[model samples]
Target: MEIREDDLTGQQIIALLREHLENMHEITPPGSVHALDLERLRSREITFWTAWEGDDLLGCGALKELDPTSGEIKSMRTPAAHRRRGIASKLLEHIIEVARQRGYTHLYLETGAFPAFAPARALYQRYGFEYRGPFGDYADDPNSTFMVKTLVG
Candidate 1:
């Protein structure tokens, strides 16, 4: 799979992001959801990427700078046809590598605590992320689980 930077304006990337927003809204309780909006993504706070297999948009994920030593994962999603094919894992690994190359020493993420988010939480755990208290603009919320992974590079 090809992993590359996304400008947030590409039709396929935009549609995939919209899908992520829709899914987050459907699965996460309204008051606890923290997915970024299009405008924020278009800004410099985030670095976004799309994963592709030839012309097929397999998945996408983003890393946002929360500070000099750490970042947050955002907008991770895999197309319906591509789920369970290791696309999200590949995208996530790419994001982690990118963060390390960019000098980030830690990566944090907030995902739903619901059953639908089980696979995602498990994936993060496999990558060595440990549960953590809320950071940045986040607070303790019953609907969200916060996690972090320290980078060795």
Candidate 2:
């Protein structure tokens, strides 16, 4: 599988992002859904990437610079057909590596607190992320689970 920076111009990427938005809305409460829309993902602060196998898109993830030394993981999605094949894991690894390369001292992400988000929480935990309280513009929200990983000593 190949993971590379994406400009989010492809139809496939757009569709996948749309699906991600839909899924987030379906699972999270109205005020708690934090998934970035296409416009938000394209912001200057965010770097987006997609995982591909030959011509097939496996998944996508993004790193959003919250400040010079920190970032927030966003828009991580692996289509249902590509689930359980380590696609999301690979994408997450790539995002973390890129964050380190960019001199980010830390990375944080907020995911749903629902059962549907268990697998994702597990994936982050496996990668050394620990549960944390809300950061950035986020406040206390029972529907969200915040996690963090230090990228620098």
**Highest lDDT, which number?**
2
For candidate 1, give the lDDT of residue 34. 90
Leading candidate by TM-score: 2
Q: lDDT tens string, model 2, 78-141?
A: 9999999999999999999999999999999999999999999999999999999999999889
lDDT of 1 by residue, 1-153 (tens): 899998888888888888888888888877987988788887787898889889889998889999888899998889889999998899899989988988888999999889989999999999999999898989899899999999973
Q: Work out how many backbone clashes candidate 1 has.
A: 0
lDDT of each: 0.89, 0.95
For candidate 2, report its TM-score.
0.98
Report residue 149 deviation for candidate 2 (angstroms). Answer: 0.1
Cα lDDT for residue 150, candidate 1:
90
Question: Against the hidden true structure, what lDDT does model 2 obtain?
Answer: 0.95
User: Model 1's lDDT to the true fold?
Assistant: 0.89
TM-score of each: 0.95, 0.98
Please give the lDDT score at residue 143 for candidate 1: 93
